[model samples]
Target: MKQPWIHNAKTDWWFILSPPFLVLLIIFVFQKQIQGLENHYSFYTWLFLIVFVDVAHVYSTLFKTYFVKAEVQRRKLLYLGMPVISWCLGIALFQFGALTFWSVLALIAVFHFIRQQYGFMRIYARFEPDNWSKKIDEVAIYTATVFPMLYWFKTPRAFTWFVNNEFDWLKNLPDYIGVITVLYILIVTVWIIKTIVEIIKTKTVNIPKTALITGTYLSWYFGIIYY
Candidate 1:
């Protein structure tokens, strides 16, 4: 049977598979250069990564949703009210304190990122039967992301989500981090072993799903842990 791709093979490959892998590839290729840019051209680097890329992603959402007539009509309340609701919520958060606002927003952004990754995985796997292998993929993907974030919450890190010390408001559990790390390792190993066995059994691989799962694992590992 032909592979069931959401937007056909090539488009899905470029959009989903290429991006995270490319990010890792680019960083590995330019690690020293990236460091130098952060050290010296810090402002420009922020502009490129956050302003050009991150904020641009927000703007790009319009083309896919708000700009589409059916999408807008399907969720008029969502499209219309969400912005105002978000604005009011932000104001409320800000009233708490600057750090509180940032901390809350940062955590929400992290949660969104985690959900978005899982969303793509679910979409790619929709054609497959819901079974043990599928469950492994789900758990593996979540662990790939949540493990790093749990590390972020439970331990001190050299990085920040948005601004400095944004995660300080989170509970710290340095003592349990080791145990969490072990659990993360076991899950990931099981995923790898099961994936290999599945491939051998079926004599095929789901490219989009496999790439997304592995890409997420590597991305979170390097972004949250290795960095």
Candidate 2:
């Protein structure tokens, strides 16, 4: 049977599962000190945040695919061809403009991040039967990740994806953020009601899934919208 925690309580809470929330917590507590990092500690910040976290995560994919002989042999053509194809496509994008290239990459990274979080939610909910609630869970997770991105597009802020001004072209739009905010509030309200009803009826809460969803909302909101 599928379990609530991914690995175990300590591992999940400290590392694999709750790291995003913890990172946000650190950001919150160190808000004043963390400011002006770009001016003062650009190299250190880039080394830790971008190289260690982001690039390391991307490179770790190789360990699962290319590093495994069976995985490589199972799909040799795919294993070999995809890297070349990606490189060529990346070159083609760069030929357009640096802004175009980086912007596309940044957006792709955003989508990848969203899907990974959604995957975690699904894994946590694996034991639950298929139902409308599952669909709502999917919607809530997507909205939690997506709304902040959309909000970022309309309103420029301090945070950046890959480089400075990567999102500049997307800023400014019709006054629909208010509408989106209302929809976001509506969705959160519905999710709250759904969770409360589930707890009342079943006398059990899907702890991991709830934590995943709630952490996603808070992290994205603070990382993108609030900051």
Candidate 3:
């Protein structure tokens, strides 16, 4: 029988991935206070945030794509054309405006991050048959990942996705965002309570799923707040 907290060797979630990510989160949170880092901090952030995680996550697909000959053959057109199409789209967006380019890219990155959590949840729940559990997992992860983004849009922070006042357009939208933010917090609280109750009833846990949710919550919350 599969244990609730861990999988066998073939399915272990590689707990090793969490520590370095948490370290990165800590570094990101305190970046501005580091005196000598004023000029070079962006470089390190780009290295860790962009190169290490962002770019590495993209290439991580190699395991499911190019490495599997049959899968490659199945998605041959997608594999062959996505790069070229993405390149063209990128140039077009940049030409439209650098702000347009970066904003769209940042939005896409958020979508990727959200989907990655869903994917991990699916993997961790592969043996689970309870749809309610899956649904709650989705809601919790989405709340954790997306609330920070809502916070960012409503309250500007030290970091920005684009330059040259490109996002100034958003400032004039409305004032009811405060209400929405409160509702968001309430919903997140409810989800947490629901999850805890379910865990008590089941008397078991999915360790990897729990880790992903916690990491997403911590990272997104701190990343945006500190940004």
Candidate 1 worst ten-residue window by lDDT? 167-176
- Relative to the true structure, candidate 3 reaches a TM of 0.74
C-alpha RMSD between model 2 and the true structure:
2.0
The residue-by-residue lDDT of candidate 2 on 135-167, one tens digit each, is 999999999999998888887576677888888
Question: Per-residue alpha-carbon lDDT of model 1 for 1-96, expressed as tens digits?
Answer: 356588888998887788888988989999999888788988898789889987898999889998899999999999999999999999998998
Clashing pairs in 1: none
Best by TM-score: 2
lDDT of 1 at 134: 92
The lDDT of model 3 is 0.71
lDDT of each: 0.87, 0.87, 0.71
Off by over 4 Å in 3: 1-17, 24-40, 60-74, 91-96, 162-166
Model 3 agreement with the true structure over 135-172: per-residue lDDT tens digits: 77777878776777766766765655545454555567
Q: Is candidate 1 or candidate 3 better by TM-score?
A: 1
- Residue 63 lDDT (model 3): 99
lDDT, model 1, position 185? 93
